[model samples]
Target: MGRRAVFDDPALRLANNLLDVGRADLHRRIVAALHDSPLEESYVGDVQDQLAAVVTDQRVAERDRREASRLIGIGDDLLAAIGRSGTVLMVWRRSPQQVDHPGQNMPLARYESDGIYQGSWGDIETFESSPELRTLAEALNWAQRRAPHVIVRPWWNDDTHYWAGDGPPPDGMDALPDHHR
Candidate 1:
C-alpha cells in the first residue's frame, strides 16, 4: 500500500481549529488546546510570526487582529519556557479549591528526577509557594533556588518534560499523553 494519510496530528488540528474559532474566545481556546500538546519551538515561532503578520495586516478584522496580538503573548511565553535549559522545573497552577487556602490560585513547582525506566522521569520534591506570589515568573524564580538553570515547563499545560542537564528531549517525549492535568 502507498503511504497513508495521517489526519490525527495535534499540531495540524490546532492550526485548523485556530482558523475556525471565534475571535472572542481565541486566546483561551488556543491555550486550552495547547495545554493538551504544546507545539514545537519551530512551530510556535512560525505561528507567532503568522499571527504577528495578521495583527499588522490591514485587511484582517479588527477583532481578529486584537486576538492575534493576545496570542502573540502566549507564543512568547511558551517559546521562553521551552527554550530554558538546565534542570527541569515543572510548575502547576492550582485552583483555590486545590490549595490549602481558599482565596486565590497558587503555583506549585517540582523537579523531575530520572525514573527507574530509561528515558522516563521520576517525581522528587515539590514546592507550593504562598498565594502572594501570583505569577509563573515568581514561581519559577522561587523554584530556581533549589536548582539553577532549569528548563521550566508548565506541568498541567504541557507534555514535554526533561531532567536538568539533559540536552534536547528524546524522540517521542513530546507525544507523551496528557497525564499532568
Candidate 2:
C-alpha cells in the first residue's frame, strides 16, 4: 500500500484553500469576519511576519508553527463571521512625523463595518456618508460607559494591545471628542 500524502490531510487542504485567497481580499474578509474578536493592534505585524515565515519554511520552529496555527484559527473565525452583519470599531494613529502635514493628527479612531483598529492620536477623516460613523459612535459610547475618562489612549492587556474597550485608557487623555473638549 502507498503511504498517505501530506496533501491528503483535510486541515492542510482547508488552509491551502484559504491561502489561495488574494492577500488584500483575505485581510479585508478576515477583518470583516472577526468583528467581535479581541482587538490586538500589535499582533497585526507579528502575525503577518510569522505567517509569512511559516509559509516559506517547511521546517519552521515550533514557536512559529504555534503562532501560525493561532493566526489560522483567527482567520477561520473571521471567515465564519462573514455576512453575519455586525460592527468592528477600528482605531489608529498617524503622527505628524509619519505624514507631511504638521500637527495634523487630532484624534485616532477608524473602522470598517466589522473591525476596529485603535492607536495613538492622528487626523480623523471619514466620508460624510460613511456607514461606519454609527459604529464609531457606538464604540465611543462603549468607551464612555466603560471608561469615563481617558477615552482614546491605547493600552495592552492579557498580551493584547487593546484600546478604549478592554479597560481604562491611559492618564490625562481628554475624555471628550475634539469638538467637545
Candidate 3:
C-alpha cells in the first residue's frame, strides 16, 4: 500500500467567519456585515426586512446571535457534505425523556415522508415519524428558510441540574409543563 491519509488535514476545516464567534461578537459581526452587504439595500423591499433588521441591529438588546449561528452552521455542514459528496444524510436528535449528555446517549431521528423514525442501540424496535432537498444551494436555501424555526427554548441547566418541565418524565415520573406550574 502507498502512504496512508492522515485525519487532521488542513483542507478539512472551514475558515472562520461570523459563524465562529460568541453571541456578543457574532451580533457585532452580523451588524457590520449587514451594513457592508447587499442585504442592506435589498432588505428595503423584502417582506422579512423588519425581522432581519432586528437581528442585524446593534441596538437590539437580545440579538439571539447564538441561534442564528446554529442555523447557519447547519447550512454550512450541508454544504460541506455536498462539496465532498453529491448527497448528504442528516440526522436529528430526539429524546422522549430528557437525558444528560444527549449527544452520546439520545436516540437518533431520521426524517421520513410520513414521520420521524427513532432507534437506539439497545432497543430492537424503531419508531416512525414525519418530515427536504438535494443540491448544495438548495440545502443552504432550505436551511436559511427554516432558520426562523430555530427557537432556543431553555432545555436544561448544568448548574441547577434542572431540565425544562415540558420535557418527558424522567425515571417514569409525571412531569408537567412549566406553563401549568
Q: Which stretches of candidate 2 lie over 4 Å from their true place?
A: 1-42, 61-67, 75-181
TM agreement with the true structure for every prediction = 0.29, 0.22, 0.16
Off by over 4 Å in 1: 1-38, 79-181
lDDT of 1 by residue, 1-181 (tens): 0001111133334345555664334434334333213222354565566566657767557776776776667556642323332343444433333567676655543322211111111122111222323444554444444343344345344444533333444553442232421
In candidate 1, the residue pairs with backbone N, CA or C atoms under 3 Å apart (3 or more residues apart, or in different chains) clash, namely 87-164
lDDT of 3 by residue, 96-178 (tens): 55767757654443322222222111111111111222222333333323221111111221122212122353463333234
Ranking by lDDT: 1, 2, 3
Worst 10 residues of 3 by lDDT: 1-10
Cα lDDT, all candidates: 0.40, 0.34, 0.27
Among the numbered candidates, top TM-score falls to 1
Largest lDDT belongs to which candidate?
1
List model 2 lDDT by residue over 90-178, tens digit each.
Answer: 34233223545777764432323324424221111110111222344554553333222323322111123333333344454323334
Give the Cα-based TM-score of candidate 1 against the true structure.
0.29
